[model samples]
Structure formats: C-alpha cells, structure tokens
Target chain A: MGVNGAYACVVRTKVASTNGGKPMKDTIFIKPGQMAIEDVDKPTIQAPDDVILHIVRTCVCGSDLWNYRGIDATAPHSQNPGHEAIATVDAVGSAITTLIPGDFVIAPFTHGCGHCAACRAGFEGGCLNHDDNFSMGAQAEYMRYQHAEWSLVKIPGQPSDYSEDMLKSLLALADVMATGYHAARVARVKTGDTVVVVGDGAVGLSGVLSAKMRGAKRIIAMSRHEDRAALAREFGATDVVAERGDAGVAKVMALTNGEGADAVLECVGSEQSVDTAVQCGRPGATVGRVGVPHNAKMDLRPLFFRNTQIAGGPASVTTYDKQVLLDAVLRGEINPGKVFTKSFKLDDIDAAYQAMDKREAIKSYVIVD
Target chain B: MGVNGAYACVVRTKVASTNGGKPMKDTIFIKPGQMAIEDVDKPTIQAPDDVILHIVRTCVCGSDLWNYRGIDATAPHSQNPGHEAIATVDAVGSAITTLIPGDFVIAPFTHGCGHCAACRAGFEGGCLNHDDNFSMGAQAEYMRYQHAEWSLVKIPGQPSDYSEDMLKSLLALADVMATGYHAARVARVKTGDTVVVVGDGAVGLSGVLSAKMRGAKRIIAMSRHEDRAALAREFGATDVVAERGDAGVAKVMALTNGEGADAVLECVGSEQSVDTAVQCGRPGATVGRVGVPHNAKMDLRPLFFRNTQIAGGPASVTTYDKQVLLDAVLRGEINPGKVFTKSFKLDDIDAAYQAMDKREAIKSYVIVD
Candidate 1:
C-alpha cells in the first residue's frame, strides 16, 4: 500500500482477526496517483503486541506525495496506507502491558522492539526486529498498532485537553519533526555552526528549526517557493537562496565567505538537490541527507577531495519522540505543525494528497476523529 | 616525473632560477609503468616560503601507483613526483622564520599556509591558501619545499642524531602514518569500537595501527597478502579477513557477531573495495574513506538508507602530524615504518616502483642521501 514509497514496506504475515470484522472508514491506496477513503474491515488484534487505536488526529505526509505522484510501484492494487496519528487506545492485546484501552497516545511512523540492537543504540528507525509494515492503515476510525508496548508514546491526557494548534503540533511528532531532527543530528550540527538547509519543504523547514535548536549560529535555507521561504525564515533560517544547482552553491559560498556551510541538511534527495547540498559544505563539513533518495548518487571523489561527510536515513521516530520531541512539544518549545498549511476532513484525504502534490500546501492536516 | 598519478597536480607557475640549473639526482615520471632517477636540474627558491631540503630519506607512496599503473592523464610528460620526505633544511627562504638551516625535518605531503580557514580548522589537506601543491619533487638529492614556515616538522637535530629505524619511523609520519590516522579521525573511531580496515597496502596496514591507537576494541584488517596481514596484526589488528567482496563481508559480519564494524576505513579506492567497506559497517556507522578514489562512485542511496556516514579525503598530514602523530612516533608508541617491506637506493628507484606495482613490497623506502 502507498503509505508513501519511503514507508511502504509491506508485511507478508497476516493474522486472522480474533472477532468477526466490523466495518470502518480507512484510507487506502487504490493505485498510483489515487487515494480513497472507503469502508473496510476494522483492524483487530493481529498480534499479541497489537493495540487498536481510535484515530483522533491523522494527516497527509510529504512522503505520501511520492506514491500519489506515481513514483513508486507496488504489487497490490489497494493497501491500507497511513502512518502518522494521535489516537485513543481502544483495545489492547493481552501481551501488551505499556499501553491499555483509553490511553491518549501518538503512534510513531516506525514501531521498534525496545530490545533490538538498533533500538538500544537509539536508532529505532533501523530496528532489526521490526515488523517492516506494522504501523500502516493509520488514517482511519480504527487501526491496529503493532509493538504497542514500545511504539505508542503516551501523552498526558485525551486529545480534548489540547487546543487544535497543539494537537497539530503533537501530530507532527509522529513523523516529520523527528525526521528533520534526525537530519541535523546525523550531520552533527553543533552550536555556533553555519548550517545550510536544502529544500524548503516541510522537512527542510523543520530542519531549519532543528538546526537552530542545535545552536547553529547561522542557517542558510535553499528554497524557491515564496511561502516555504517565508516559513523557513520563521523556522529560524538566517538566509534563503532561491536559485538552485551551481547558482545555489555560489550563493551559499558567497554567504559563508567562500568557505561553504559547517553543516548541510540535504532535505531534497534529487540528483541536483543532493549535488547542491554536497557542494555547499565546507572543507570538513557533514551533510545530513534525509530526503528519500530517489535516484541520486553521491559523487564520491568530489566529497572525498572536499573532505565532506554525509550521514542520514529514515527518521528514528520512536527514538526522538520518546527521548525529547514530545516534551519539547508539550512545553510549546516547537511548532512543527506550522508546516501543515491546509486542512481536510478524513473523507477528503484525496484532495489533501492533491494539494501537496500540486505544491499548494507544505502539508495537509486531516480531521479524522 | 612519475611520482604517481595521485600527486600529479601539475603546477603551471614556472619559476626562473637565479643560478644556472645545477644538476642533482631526482625522480622524474617518464611514462606510465616507468620511473627513473636522473641527473636533473635541482629545485631552487620559487616563492618566499621556499626552502631547499637536502633529501636524507624518502619513499614511494600507494598513491604513486596510480601513475605507475597508467592512470590519470596530464599535459606534461614529465613532472617531479614525490610528496613524502625526511631531509635537512639546507637553505631557508627570506620570509620563512619557523625553521632554519641544518635542522632535520619531515616534509608533509600537503603544505598549508597554517592560517587559512581549512588549515585553521585542522584540515590542512583542504587548505584554502594552498599553492595547489608545494611539496612535489621530494624524492631527490635536494628539493625546494614551499610553505616552509608551517609545512616543515623539525626533528631535534641533524640526520645523524636518529637511528636508522627511528629515521624510517619519522619518515612514515610524512604521509602514511598520518593518512591512516585521518581515516580513524574522520570516521570517529572511538574507545571500544570494532573497526574495519579495507585494503592490504601500507596505508591500510597503517589504518590498523591508527584504529588501534584510537582505542578500538577490535581491529579487522581485510588483507589477502600473508606479509601484509602479519604486519596488520602487528599494528593492532585483532582479526584478519583474507576474503573479498561478498565473502569478505560475510567474514567480517561473522567476526562481529553479525553486527558489522563500528568504524570502517576504506583505504582501497576501487569500487569493489569501497562497496565492501561500506557493507562491513553496522547501522549508523561511519566509514572513513582516505584512498584516492579512482573511478569509484559511492552508491548514496544505500549509504543513506543504511544510516552510514562516509567521511574522508586526502590525509590532513599537517594537522595530525603537528597535533599527535609525530609525537606518537617519537615516543616509540607506533611502528608504521614496518610497512616499508623493501628498500632501494636512489639509483634503484625504478626497481622500487616495479616492486610496489607488482605487490612484491607493501612500500619501498628510498635512501637518497
């Protein structure tokens, strides 16, 4: 299913629901470039660790556009596709102990077993004991949350306890916020550094905020879109570059006194974008590449000669959300939900995807309660 | 003129000699697969920073094999090719103040102004105030060294002050020793880490020593050569895997309990070698790639998805040399010179190149005095 190509790992192991399946409205990928909200069999305990989530808040992600834009191919004609959600725990499997019915929680995009090597090392995104597709079908009335004991992060209270804006911010912790923070962390963004954030997309804007939080002295954002550029500035970008490729590199170099950036976050994974990201780093800079690499290859010799290091991958949603982002959001220290520029009802999920695909919205917030 | 392909950055700034060109025994690259020590015009002061060195000892580097193996094209058929040297400061330039005549010094491969942004940041390899190159023609009776004030590392006394073994040890500091340390530095090899050294040459063997010196808990040297593998063990390798490609990856994985290495040093710049090095790193691991990449391209998507960071370039000879490597050598803490398995007189330089090209010697030491 198109939970977006980046998070579209499918599960082959299917467990029969212990009860007769009830009907519910859930999002599904009908085919490339098309999404549908239809009546489907409501999720139930698929495993001992599974917990049924009554989705309170769900949204369309930037990655969803990859599938809606007809980029990735999948074998199934339709698969329940969604990952981000703020939800109420409706049912808990017997083995699940950390989560129970009526608990207010945010379901991270990735579910990691707490005991895995990657999880213990704080890289839950690469969890070796992962179900690979455990958290899909999240944009619905009810979705089965796997690894509930560890993957579901409990907020203080029910969704009504927070304002609409706060809920949006909490929803962001499910994916993009952590993803952006991952980029900065992997690039080793430290205090007093000059950071270059490529792509003015939601993640890129989030990266601007993350870099700022990491104590970067100056942040240069590469973006051509005016709205995104303005948002980048709001997110703490010191400079915005509209031109791309060599021209973009020239602008960053000029701004950095021909030395380039101390840390570069490559938030757009195209060849041109990645090339610009690498070229804009200083002699000993590290570039954080978090955008789903479409068909980009790093020119190794150039990176080698320039002494640039590149580090990144899928975001450790569980790791970051549990470790810091949740508390930061709760304390109103960050507003990642500002990226959700538009809104749509759960039935209008297709339009949300279209808005993002057409570049009309940085991200689309879905009202799924 | 054949110092090797990697050091063949041709300098176009021709300097006129005040004295009628005096003849000295020097190496010149005649063609691919050939090297010669001929009576050629000795180097003279070309810049204010230039100082003439009475070459006491020099050697062939792994990079030189690039030219000797018929790689990298150049407009000029003959250019002085050498970067590593231990010599006596025969003459000081007018502007040079940091060093004086009769002082024994190690000439680092890359000469930096010591005040450029890159140099100031301890990455002299990417020094902005570089002369493109300033330390070529080092394997000669007498050579002109540029950036004399900061590039020359002074030993305590004249050449006679050190034993033959100590002199060889000091000479290794000019390139290989520091280069090996560079891989570890860039990869962030830390205490209790499992490091993978991918290459069986002098630099790779030196990487084993550097990884050990960095407090790596386990050092895995990927070597097929019996002699080089033994040297790798002597240099602090805990494991030696003679397999290559997929087989090599399996071997390393098995040794690390299928977790792969914490740090990987890509000392061999070929595509196959690089791929092997990358696969041997655990999730979220960093690979230090110091080999001169010859027609090698890093598959960035794989690197990004696996959360691997690739960091490295030309070794920061000045930074590591001035900071720690030289002191380590002088203290008799490391024996990097042991990689020099064979020695040749200045007149037998051709045989030295032949031996290295055929893998008969890990490195060839040249006694030019």
Candidate 2:
C-alpha cells in the first residue's frame, strides 16, 4: 500500500470451502450462479508488454448495464464490463518504457499494441493485436495493460489532494465524456449555430456542455426529467424540448423560425431519439451520433433531400484530441465531471449500481481507499 | 420567320376575353370555363428588356394532365400548360443584349428575368420579377420573353431537318429531363456505387440514365412495368426491382451486398417513392429527390443513425448546370430524351395526355405545327 491508500484490494467474491472434496482454482466465470463479483485469481503481468495499474476509481456505463441485463449477448460472460477507470501504475514489465510504478493514469477504454495498422490510424478499438485485449476493462484491483505508452495518460498531479469531482470526471475521459466531445466536434458545430442534443444522460449532458464550449448560438437539450433538464440548462442548454419524435421536431422548428437547428447531437441509442435528432435540423444541417446502436435501420431520402449529414463512430479519446479536451477541463471551460450525481465507497458498490438502475442518479462513482 | 432557323419561332397564349367582358384589354380573365382556344390580339414588345420568340417546337408535360383534369384547381386553367419548347427569336427589344433576332433557342421550363438576386443565386425557379411568373406557357404561337439573355440557350443546330426523336429529346431539357439530372447529381453517384432510381416516369427513367452517365456501378431502377424496366435497362440501369417501398428496398439489398445502395433518386412526387428512396440506401449514403411532393410525411430516425443525407429542389434548368447537361447530350454522351415514347399533333394533344395518364405510353410529345 502507498501513503494514504492502504492495503492491496481484491475484487473477487468469496466462495464456500469444502473439506478436501475437490481442489478449485478461482477463474472468471459466466455461470448464472457466478456474478461479475465472482473471485478470479489475481492476474499477474503476463508479458513484457504489460503494466499493472491499481484502479483507484471505476465508473459503470450504459453499455455495462446492457451486459448486466443480458441484452447485448455478443460476448456472453466473456469478461468484466467496466471500461472507465482512473488508476495508478503499480508495476511495469521490462518492455514498458514510458510508465513507471506509482504514476497516476487514465487508462484507455480500448488497448492497442501501438504497432498495428489500426493503431497507426489511431483506432485502438479496432486494434489487430491477437494476444492483448485485457488492457480494455480497467475495473479490477490490479488490471494488466499492454502498450503502456499509448494506453496510459499520466495525471500530472498526485492523487492525495485531488478533488473527488475532478478525479471522478477523469473516469469520463476513459470513454463517455470524450465520446460526447467527439460527437460534437464531428458534427462541425460552428459559432452562432443552433445545436440540439438528444438524450439527457451523462453523455448527452456532456454534449450540451461541449456544444456550448464549441460556441453554439443556442443549445437545445431534449430531456424527460426536470432534474436532467435543469442540469442541462446549468451546463448551457439555451432551450429544452421535452417532446419526442415528430412533436419534438415541431418544437425545434417552432423555436428555430420554422427552420430546424443547424446541428444535432444524438447521445441516446434508442431509435426514436435518433429520428428526433435528424428531424430537428434545418436543411443542410448535420447530426453527430455516438451511441452504439443495436438494430437500428436507416432511410436516406430525408437526409439527401434536406441536405443533412450524419457523422459518428466510437470515441477515440487519446487520438490527438485528449490534450485539447484536457486543457479545456483544466481551464474550467467545461465541467463534465458534474454528471457524477452520487458517490459510494468501494465496499458499497452494489448500492451504487442499484441507485443508478432505479433512475435515482445520473451517474455513480466509487472511490477506492 | 426569316430563313426558318434565323428567325426564332415562338408562340403566345392569352385570354380571349375578361371576366367583365371588356372589349380588347391589356389584362384578361383566366377561368376554367373560359379555357377556349382563341386568337388573341398578338403580343407586342412590352418592354425594352424583352425578346419576341417565334415558337418553333413545343411539347406537353405529364403535369399538364393535372390541370386538364382540374386536379390543380387553383392553377388558373385558362393559361396554357406547355412549358417545354424550342423557338427562334423574331425580335429583340432595345434592352435585349445577348439575344438578338434570328437566333434559335431553347426556352427552359422556367421563365426568369435572370437579373434578380434569386436568379443570380441560380434559383430562377423562384425569380422575383413580376412578368417572370408564368407570363405565358410555351403552347402558344409567339412569346415575348423578358430577360432573354438569361432564360434562353441558343439552339446548337438547325431545326428543319431535326429528327422527331432529337427534337423531343431536346425539348426534354426544358423540364423533366433536367429535373432527373438534378436529382441524380444531388444524390452524389460515384464509380462503383449502387444507385436506386425511384419512379419509372420520364424523370425517373432519365434519372437511371443520369446515374449511369455519372458512373454509378450498379443502377437499380424501380419501376412497375416491364416496358419501363426495359427502357431503364436501355438507359443503363444494371438491375430493375419492380417493387415499391420496403419490398423495393429488400430487392435492392438483395442485389447489393446486403447493404443498401450508395445513392437513391426519388423522382415521383408520392410519399411512397420518397420513403422507398430513403429505405434503399446504406449508412452514410445520400438520396436525391426532385419531385414536387404532393404530400410527404417522412420519418427522420434512419437518417441520423445511418448517416443518410437528402437534398433537392425544382429543376432550375434555366439557371443551374443545364448548359453542362446540354453539352453532354449534344455530344451523345447520354441520351435521356429517349423517354418520350409517343407523339401527336397539337390537335391530338388530348389523346397524347390520355396515353401518358393511362400508362399506355411512358411519355407523350405534341407537335405544335
């Protein structure tokens, strides 16, 4: 253990011991009886390319909820779900060059070996490495990371005095916050342009803030809850339209002089939200969507005839834009960390998830000691 | 008309009498009951900015049937319906600069003064000049055209020996053919791209040809009839999916690699065609629609998520890209005029309209002489 952070943390759940009946080695399992908390033997550095990070903070995501609910069964029980975490480098293998022990870092959501074509193209999500996929999920007490130089962003200051809000927000830099920034930037928000954001989730609220920081003349936040809408306003959403779909389009039109908004950010994954985002723009408008879709189909006629364009993809956070966004946050240009509405100790993780699932909290953060 | 080709033959149509039965007046009444063809006192040069054209060749359009059937009840029926014509200049007013007497020309479907700001922006269809508003349809004997320099393109060759096919094809540039070109171009076809042309009428068929000329790799023509499909193939459509809306999209997808087309052109004014065009594109595709939609209610969801774009307007042949298209046709690079499937004398115009309306012919032409 280091200074204020004491004791080595273990993430595995306890199991009943049988007297000499059978010897069992704990391993990650997806059986119905085995929840994500099921104990797995501590993972050691498996290769010279690996660096172990002691996760200091971990955040849950909408996608993690899908895995938990068994909706997105693409990789059933394949691995743990958490992809957003802030940590400190505990150890580096012989080959790891840039990162040393005790360096605080925001781990990339996806890990790349940094030598492949995709990594060269800055798309770590599509990294071609066949041997190293563990650098992605940063949820455990000790997470092994490959390609340490590219996978880690060293927090410039020590963690002892860091504000909980600022530290919790760095979890967003792992994925959600950066994803929203990518969406807004890709939509080409210009000065004096009207921007509409669909979804009032953490990513959406972040987009509202991002659009404002991008100099949008007006930012309209589409939300259902009073609290989220109020947060959106506090984050610089100039208008809020609570309607959905066609009615939402009409509301946007009414506000935009019968012409729709100039840009739209679709941060929700639902089909209805997607449609509303496109319809809430004027001719020659653009919509940037970052929500990972499940089974959404598309129509081209409206987009073509109205001269609207859509641009979106997975958020490549550390791909040349991390410093830009980091500088903005450091200078207080955006306060994306404000989305963390609830906090819990590492011991009460289940309660944090329960609070979030009940819609009682926009986001939850678990701090490690 | 001097030397047949030298003097621009034109035609003019005017109300024979006013609603008040005033004796010979400058302004006349235009009512459905008063649509009798009458010899009005011939038009004299009205302004220094005018050019009197002798109507040499004129043809009817499918939209003309709408007026004759009283479907467009507010369109002022007593006014002529013909907009496609080729003519020769008989006289030029003092302010007429580029156009002179004895020049044969093609008067585009729209009549624009061409000097207004809107016209300057290549939106002659929305010209602001008073006389540019349907001053006279091309079905008459002589036409006094304002803004002659901007509204007319000098005929490339003599009209006397012109084949009926060539003349009919040339006449197409005045409207539908150009509209099809606009639709296809807006759809943004490129090499190795699959395109779906919705609508099998003249404009749609011409769109098939336009897509082919624009290097579309696989042209899927959606038509209801075998004859139109055959014509579409002749015009270079690689495939013909004789279905509508969703089914048509399935057929296109089946032909493509389970992905929809890269481009879709909606040429029919029906909501069905609009939806079908939208459904027939892959993610990040475009659909171009040029039809004047009779009624269109669209869903905007697929556009935002799938990254589809849409753009279109009336065929601004008088002010946009028509010269480039005309040059291509004159060089036989593409022959969209083949859509005219039947012809009739002006006296048999009723039969011509019936033929097209009943689907007995793809398109009908009227020989004014």
Candidate 3:
C-alpha cells in the first residue's frame, strides 16, 4: 500500500500541433463599430508554459467599444479582441505539469505567467513576461495561453447543467466583474461605508454588486440613463442621482446626512467621470477608478484639499483572488454576471457590437454555437 | 512630584493685542500680478482653541502665484498669500494649553486640532473642522491659529549665539522643507532606490535634500533652467534631465539600465509634470506628487498596468513626522534652509513677490526688520 501511494502519475495524451480536426481557422477583430471575422491559422502551444484552449464560449466587453472606435492606442493590433472565455484544454506542452487535455477552464482576459514578481505578489496583470507582450486574448477559435496553471481556473466538472446566463455571468470573473471588484476593493468599501459609483455601464453596475457584497450600507449610483439606473438598483444600489456636478454632489450629500460618500468608484474613464468622482467624495475618502480614459485630466488641488486618495489599477483577474471571487459567486453572495443582458451567436458577432454601440444592450455575449 | 506629573500644568502671560507699532494695519491681495494693499483690521483670535502668532518672517510660494493669476478659484477673496511663517506667540485663549506668550515658533500653513480622528491618524491636514474651512493662513502681520498645541512647532532654545541666517533657515521648516520631506516619505524612497524629482523650485530643491537624507542611491532632477539644475545638483541631485516627454523618459531609463527610476516626486501640478513623473517610474515604482495641480490628466491604463502607485496630500507639516524631520535639520543631516536665496524687508514685499513670479529667485523671505 505504501509503494502504491508513491506510484508515478500517468501522462495524458498531448494534442501536439498534429492531432486535431482540419484545425478551425477563424478569428475576430473589431474596428470602429464593425466586427471582422476572418480566416486565420490555428494557434499552437508556442512556449513551454503555454497551453492551447479550444474556446467554448466568448463574450463582448464595454472596453471593446474603445478598440471598435480605435481609441485605446495600446490595444493589440489585429490577432484577437476578446478576453473573457470558457474553454476546454485541447493540448499541453511537455513542460506543463498542472493541466491536461479535456480539462474545463475559464481564461482570464489578461494572463500572466505564474513566476514573475508581480504575479507572485498577486498583481498578475502586470506580469513580467520575457517572451510576449500580449499573452492571451480569447476571441479566436484556438488560443495560446501563458502561465497555464495560474491563468486557467478549473471548473470541477462540465458546466452543462448551468444556464447560459449563469455561465455568461461566471465569464465576468475573467475581467469586468473582477475589475468592478478591484475598484471596490481599492476604494476600501466597508460595512456602513457610503459608496458613490460613477458610470452605469457594465463595470459600474458590477461595482454596485461588488459594494453590496463588501457590506456597503448605502450605494449611490450616479447615472443619467433610466435603464442603467434601474439596473443599478436591481444590483443593490440604495440610491440613484440623475443630476451632474454641484447638483449631483448636493443630492449625494443630502442622502448621506450632509457628508459625502465614504468611497467613490469611477467606472467610466473620462474627464467628467473623474471630476464627478472627486466631487462626490467626503473629506479623507478614496475614489477608485477603472475607466481606461481616452483623454483624462485630473485637477489635483480638489483631490488634495478634500483629502481624497485615488487608487485603481488594471484588475489582476488571473491572480489568486479570482478563485475566492468565483467561490463568492457560487455561494450566492453576488451575481456579477447579471450585467450581461443580451446574447448572440458567434456567427452574428456584428450585431453584438452594433447593439452595444447603439446602447441597445448593456453587455452582450457571443455563444460559439 | 508624582502628583505634579498627573496634574494640569499652568503657564500664563497677559499678551497685548498689538505689537506696539501702529498695529500693522495693511493686508495685501493680488490679481493677475497686481497687488492691492488695503487697510484692514489686524486679525485677532476669535475661537478659544485659537492662538495668535506675531509674524516675523513670511515667504512667497509658487502656489501663491496661482492665486495672483486667479487660477485657483478657492483662493481667499482678498489673498494674504503666505503660508510659511516664523512667529512669536502673541496671545492665547483659556482653552489653548501648549502655546504661551514669548515662545518663538513656526506655524504650519494649515492647523489641525490634535484631538480629531484625522490628527490622531497623523493626517492632520484632513481634520474635520466646524469653525473654519482651513485654519487661518500664516500671512499678514498677525495669524489666528486654531489647535495651538497641534499646529505650532516651538523652536529649540537658541544657543545664545544663533545667527539670523540659522533662524531664517529654520523657518523654512514651516512649509517647503517639510512638504518636500513629506513627498519623499510618501514616495517611500528606499536605500538604493533611484529617484527622479520633477521641478527645480524651492520644494523640488528641498526634495533633493530630502532624498539625500532618505539614502537614495541616485537622484535625477528634472529642470529646464541651468541655474536651478545646478542648485539641484549642489543639493544632491546625482543626475539632471533637461528634456521633457519621451526624450526625458528615455534619458532617465538610460541612466537606470532601461528600467526607469524606482520613485518619482512630482512637485509641479501641471498635466505634463504629472505625466512625466508617471513616465519616469519603473514597474512597481511610486510617484508622490505635492503640486496643487492646475489640470492633471493622468492616464489610468498606464498607471494600472505598470503597477505604479500615486500618493500625496497637502503636507501635514505639523503632524506626526514634522519633529523627526526637524531633528535631522538640527543635526546637519539636511540643510534645506540654504534654499532661501533672497530676503526683503516688510516694505519690499511687492519686490519679493515679483522676484518669485519672475523666477529670479528660488525662495524669497520677507523679514520684519
């Protein structure tokens, strides 16, 4: 019995660049409101640490609109545009030890190899990769993943029993949902802490859910759109302010007994959003912003004199904390996936972008059916 | 003797309301480089916690220039325009306990009662006050300081042979020197950490001294002028970058093995200064900005992805760490007071402002004599 306990683990079959169906050749890219589906070569395990994932389902993101309009200059050139995906491992490299073919996994929008200092310190999104700049984006048929162990979350079993809505919501654990949580976490929302969320888009809505999970006593969602405000309420917003600037600040103060919210999360990255976030905070409060601003200008005097602290960085979704958040969702503590209100077929990707751009949907997911 | 330690100690003096010379009946305000010296009543303490300081040496600041040009709307309606001053305790109220008449002291720009939560937490600059917005500024002939014990730093007893230069230099501790130290500390300049300091003004020059005291391995001073840059080098700047933007970042990178500096101090609050400070930082580096930014448009994507943290506030000079910094100055570990390059009589105050505005002097002190 002791000898059997020390037996070597059997190796699984590798999907070596060879054992595949006439390798699927399709990739998606977005350009200024239009989606392009073009034929492309299938990706292979390029590095020892990389694993090939056959994308099972992928989704549209609010951030995609920036690249759809060519605003995010640093955005990847043309390979793939999606970051959230549920996938099945199709291949493993010889150097890979933790993953095997046939494992069901969720891929984070941004992946970092597990060994960099940043990754070790739990800031995986800022990993120091010696071989690649853009590691793994999920909008393609087959994606090459770096740091397979850290980047992929193993689903205990096939999630066939889960509804598409449930799966799509879980997809947010890859980025948007995590981004919202990161914003709330950085803002240090505590029990009885008044929170003001700027922006009613997907991340902002998700932020309402996040603040609620963090035990925020009152969450004030600042939005002009009726639909978004309603969605914010559904997601646990205790109050909603439709006004902007001094009027909005007045409304927030009125709701908080003349003291502003203890924390403000700027989910939209605009000059207006930043200014709004700053003005909504009480003295010595913090404002955590995740909006990747196209052209951002922050006046430091208001922030300094009001004793405001601004802290938010790219969400480290692939870090160790992702598992904790995933468990939170499974435990019914939060349903971040509620932000997705629309779904579409992968072949009809163009409609997904159009619907999001026209504000017809808050968030859209594309099923690879 | 044992009971005496537990009992409330008492010290009393009947201080006159005036300095015995015409009551100094002039208050000055500036508008777009224009000075309006108007006759106003000499300021007196109105709150029980307030103590009056007889201004002996007050100096002009780069921040005051913003008020002169009307860029800071929050600037007092009739700006007295000085925040750094050495004064003698002129009067005190019954509620005031620590400060007494005849004590020579340096009054910080803003005052905080030591009992507030913010003061207890060492961020006295964020004190929640019911009486006034900011404690009375240290300009004019007399200042009404709130929270006397917590707001004033008594000067060490003169060795009976202390020189006038030594005293004025000590006065620099009231603001610039302390602020510079605060910025360096917030940036967390470690031993062997490469630090890049933007701006060559009094605060920037003082930052160099502060960095030296913190044991920074390399100090890069960013300045455009030759004289200021030379002064920075003299004050312990190991390298100087005269360029701005990508070129400046490249120079700093080249100096630091292409990784960039570990810490950057942004002493100027403009958008360009903030960006430059962000640009000079390496991954996991920090940027501490103390400038009252006019318009600071910081990009969140880069800041987040690079894992750089930005932290700063109005220097809580008289708070927890002021004494620690002051002791260094007294011990000769730092001589930041050398920054006082010009001095003026109270009648030559206009010339003092002109000199600072024109950048003809780093710092100009107005002596009561």
Maximum-TM-score candidate: 1
**Docking quality band of candidate 2, CAPRI definitions:** incorrect
In candidate 3, what are the lDDT values of residues B1-369, reduced to their tens digit?
A: 000111121121123345442344333654456554443445567778778888877777787676555554232335454667788888997887787887878777657766654565455666665434243345567767767766788877632335667666677777788778767877878788789998889998888888888899899998888888988998899999999888898898889776677789988877888888988887656787877766644446567656576777677678623657667766766677677788877667678778888888888887762
> What's the candidate order when arranged by decreasing TM-score?
1, 3, 2
Model 1 chain B worst lDDT window (10 residues): B9-18
Order of the predicted models by lDDT, top scorer first: 1, 3, 2
Best-fitting candidate, measured by DockQ? 1
lDDT of 1 by residue, B1-369 (tens): 111354444432223343685678877677777777666666778888889999999999877776667766443346546788999988988999988788889998878778876777667777777646436777779888877788788888788878888888888988888888999999999999989999988888889999999999999999988998889988999999999999999999899887788889999888898899889987788999888887545567777666888898877787787888888988999878898889999898889989998889889999988
Off by over 4 Å in 2: A1-369, B1-37, B41-52, B75-77, B91-95, B111-136, B144-148, B319-323
Cα lDDT of model 1 overall?
0.82
Candidate 3's displacement at residue B212, Å, is 6.4
lDDT of 1 by residue, A1-369 (tens): 112465554432222343565677877777777777777667778789889999998887776666666667554445545788999999999899897789999888877787765677666666677546336777778888877788789999888899999999999888888889999999999999999999888889889999988999999999999999998998899999999999999999999898888889988778888888888987888999888888645567777777888898877787888888999999999999999999999999889888988889998889987
Which candidate do you rate higher for DockQ, 2 or 3? 3
Clash count, candidate 2:
30
> Ten-residue segment with the worst summed lDDT in candidate 3 chain A?
A1-10
Q: Against the hidden reference, what TM-scores do the models get?
A: 0.94, 0.58, 0.74
**lDDT, candidate 3, A58-171, per-residue tens:** 777777666566554222335445667888898988888878898878777656676665565455656666424233346657777776766778765676756776677677
